[model samples]
Target: MEGLVKKLNRRNFIRVSAIAGGGFVLGFNFLSSCSPEQRPGQLIDLNAFVKIDTNGEITIMNPNPEVGQGVKTALPILVAEELDVDWKDIRVEQAGLDTNKYTRQVAGGSGSVRESWESFRKVGATARQMLINAAAMGWAVSADTCHTENGMVVHKKSGKKAKYGELVERAATLDVPQEVNLKSNAAFKLIGKRIANVDNQAIVTGQFKYGIDTKREGMLYATIIRPPAFGQLLESLDDTAARKSPGVKQVLKFENKIAVLGQSTWEVLQGAKMVKAEWKDDGILESTTDYSKNLKSVLLNEPKEESRRKDGNVLEAFSSAAKVVELDFEAPFLAHNTMEPMNFFAHVKKDSAELYGPIQTPERTRTRIAELLGIPEEKIAIMMTRMGGGFGRRLMSDFVEEAATVSKLAGNIPVNVIWSRESDMSGGFYRPMYSYKYKAAVDNDNKLIAWHHHSVGVGSSAASGDSFPAGAVANFQVDTEEYKSPVSTAPWRAPTHNFIGFSEQSFIDEIAHKIGKDPVAFRLEMLEQAKNNPIGKVNYNPDRFATVIKKAAEVAEWGKKKAGNVFQGFAAHFSFETYVAEVAELEKQADGKLKLKKIYCVADCGTVVNLSGAETQLEGGIIDGIGHAMYAELTLTKGKPDQTNFNTYRMIRMREVPEVEVHFIQNNEKPTGLGEPGLPPAGPALANAVFAASGVRLKTQPFIKSGLFA
Candidate 1:
């Protein structure tokens, strides 16, 4: 029984947990599609979908959404492990926009595998159990005596065996295992090993489809024209020219917006540009520089709400401080810049509404659409497609609403509302621009004393003005002076952490340099302080924090350096229960530009499920941080984003790609997040290096320093 239980849990295979005499089973499809009718487009033909046919070919319905994050490969590897099938014999198919079998789509937050880890295993394990039980009942043997291996249950005592494929029909009728035993880390044959992305073949072959590649029969493509400035309404419009344009279906004008509904994407693009509409500028709105300057002014005068740490008298500590280092930092707004942009396909009829697009939170989006359309949530079907890149972009349902509204406008015809690169840029859900004022001090013996950091920034887009100030920082005292824009805001990967990464860590770097201590050593000292004696009441895990920092130092040769122009700075951060530490090496090029030669990041994110996928995230996240550190900035000159696309809104390119080395700390603990933790450390490490290289205390962000730009 123990052997079978261990086996059952190890692969998320079938269980006799709730079954009587003869047991039951379920596979990947069974779990992902517990109730087939509920899933939007469940597979009717089980042959091509996941099934154990006569020959025991373990077929799997490859969950849609080819997220570059490696879920397409990592998720199936989880299922294949649980199913106990020869991985070489597994068959995969793109689960069509089917909500029944593939609900809760739009993969982000590094959740595809971890969130569905046990559940997907249950699906595969249950199916295998059912197969084994059926074979046992047929052979008149006790199910306990028969154990499954490589898709066959062998009656070890009698040396009798039967293939799982020979009992598919009977297996499908068995009940699912409610309670499943998961495999120990030691028994894992596939997980934690390097598994290549499953969709690489389809993507390389041009067979993989993103939302931009989505095409439907008789589906009209459309483009929208929103007010250029928030609080600005279109006073007038001219549609005559657009109506005459080739393949243009209709020109739509509603309140402050316009849409060029057309037959193809090109026609919509051309028509929308031709159908010119003028808008009076809403001068009352705030521009980038205006907001920055005003926010800085307001934060100094205004007192903020408090919900975080505060212990021994900060005022008294500051008053008696022998030395104090105080500085302010600012960061511009950021665009998600997802290559596919925000687009959705919606077909709403009287009976039901069917939708397909790229979304990170399909469950949440479905509920939002149901409320807006006044349709029952059950009747609203959602399908997810491969995201070009989310970066926390698709979490917004505004695009989904836009599609539904357009579909209703097109006389309930299936409408695919697509936003161009400019639309994506101007549509305006941005990484909120922020400012930080920090003051840190040290006493006579160079012992760190009081540290005070005041944070200011735009609120969460998902929560709007309703969020951010509530619990954005620890010891967080945030003063939110609402800079309301018609331009919406939403979650950009790591939320306020992006700005805090710049503000807190960079300020810490300044403090590190003043105290004449290694930046890594300084943060570790804080972690030590935070652990041995915390300042106030906050939910911070200092042990993990110290572990990551110490581990990072070990891997990066944090203290030892032979000597070269390459100046190294190290930083570590803990967020979302994951710990990451980064060491960056930088030197001045002959051209006066900074050259990032290498970055070594050691992460303790608990158990690493897929080595290749986690490493990719580490690499991508590091580069993402580098891009924001070195070049990426969203400046506002005239109440509109200045850097609209990649041309001005530059991302780190291949040549600028730093040599990144990632090492994961192995442990028996369950996995935590690997997505956003590494991001917080890059800016501080790089900034510290800049100081070491130039002998200039680089205190403020837009790290190049305005004088350098000038």
Candidate 2:
């Protein structure tokens, strides 16, 4: 059995024995120095992420959630490379939620690599230094003469070598180094290599456990029957038939919804369907309808939050311009459509509770659970599982809260709340629908003069107002109009940039067309302005953005002809601290339809870690962007979503996937975000390509509805 074997108060260090396979656990709590403030019996410290056992096997704890973004594999690679351990000899374990120990345990904004890169490398370097010190002491040689390679310390003068396992006992006695040396990029062995995911075998063999697969002893299944439309209040409920259903355990009513519990998921689903309920409309339908029309009206008349960005005389620029281009773009709300739906398992007692699920922000989940159950924050334990897909969907913990509430009401019998496919799809909290009106002025020489834009949406939480061209253009102004809706919304994928990139890039392409300039060359000129001329404050690196744009164009043969009737569209954007450019190739089919033939993408996120993982993320992001831009749409009718499941809500099919080529700029700069940067350029590039082929510019998303794809 494992135990808390050691507690060294000198440095606030603690150890647990026999982890994974009889290895010692080490952790440091800097807060331990401030007593009285630091709670008793609780050691809130950054725990040791690397462990070594007697057999020379190692375990690396991954502190962030793995929502198919490949952080599960990429972060651990940093640890193994710095520790000088062979990739084959190490295993990765998903760390339990402990915000104090793993300070930035949450995963969002594509920051997993950027945030953990240095600290995790330091963790490995520190452990490696301790092992080398122990080996040098054992060999009676100078520590400087001892070098580490492949998890072993070698003494050059005496030709003595010791495995890390042999030095673990001695290493634990050494003081933690204040600063340890980290290897240069050239010395990395595992970081940049093409390494398979540590859990690939388990995944392929169907042994991987996701949040939906979480189970416990005496666990009950639950299904929530919520209102069909937003702002609807439950008027009455009839759970008599549900309670008599087969395998039905209990039916409970909440303030806004009803929950049906059973011994199995199928029974819970059946029971939920049987419990009839009526809801009163809370004026949601009267306030919102015909999303596009309402948004346009709001943009014209509603009071707006105007962004503070003025560089030149915008009124004079537009009045004296040789030409002006105006376009309006709209996109509908989008659902995440996570394959594993929303689910969580909660077992709450009087003073403590344990929640296990796939949560992107476990800290938020813990806090919400505590507030809902009236338990202390420390009493809640959150265990994260492998997620099927997050795409910014799991960032919110509403499902976890429901499970905790149901568990409390069910006498703390371990309850697992599962959202049905319909409920998951129809439920609110989606990517906010948005509309944009852009007006641009250009001189006779085809140089851009001024830019004005107004955006209307339900909320401006994520990426709504921060358009990229703000600093790139000399005179730019932005305004946003908001429409209050009971339908909840949150960030989806790249947040506001996802849709803004499509609209903004597409509009820029249109301006280029009106001026009889190549789209790629026009964008290049803009980047050069941000690079050389004086802009207010360019948030993106002009050199990096231009590099990716040039690289993507070079790779895709920007203006060159292909074998068939193919045309190319190019777009570039910076988001999440990373720069990416993409080009989509469209072929005119014989049936008057545009076939996506191929795509080329180039990214510069700095210091590549796990080349294979980064490429996978880029490919996934590009495809996701293409799917949402081409076919995905969620419309509201009478305050109710029109689509529920995949049948009504479409997605990009495998048959529609084009040949994708991904490239990354090589550099030693700190790695930035990868999971989201590739996505922002995909939609605009695709739409631009379609226009080049058909001369029909798409001013709205979901080309299917816009009649461009059709």
**Every candidate's CA RMSD:** 6.0, 5.2
Evaluated at residue 99, the lDDT of candidate 1 is 51
lDDT digits (tens) for residues 29-130 of candidate 2? 434432223222221223337778867878888878899889889888877887899898888899988865566477788877876666567667777888
In every candidate, how many clashes are there? Answer: 22, 0
lDDT per residue, candidate 1, 484-579, as tens digits? Answer: 555567768766666666566666777777878877777777667666666454355677667877887887777676366567777666655577
Top of the candidates by TM-score: 2
**Runs off by more than 4 Å, candidate 1:** 1-55, 59-66, 92-108, 139-144, 172-179, 460-482, 537-540, 590-593, 699-701, 704-710
What TM-score does candidate 1 get on C-alpha atoms? 0.87
Which portions of model 2 show Cα errors greater than 4 Å? 1-23, 26-48, 286-289, 461-466
* Candidate 1 local Cα displacement, residue 107, angstroms: 3.7
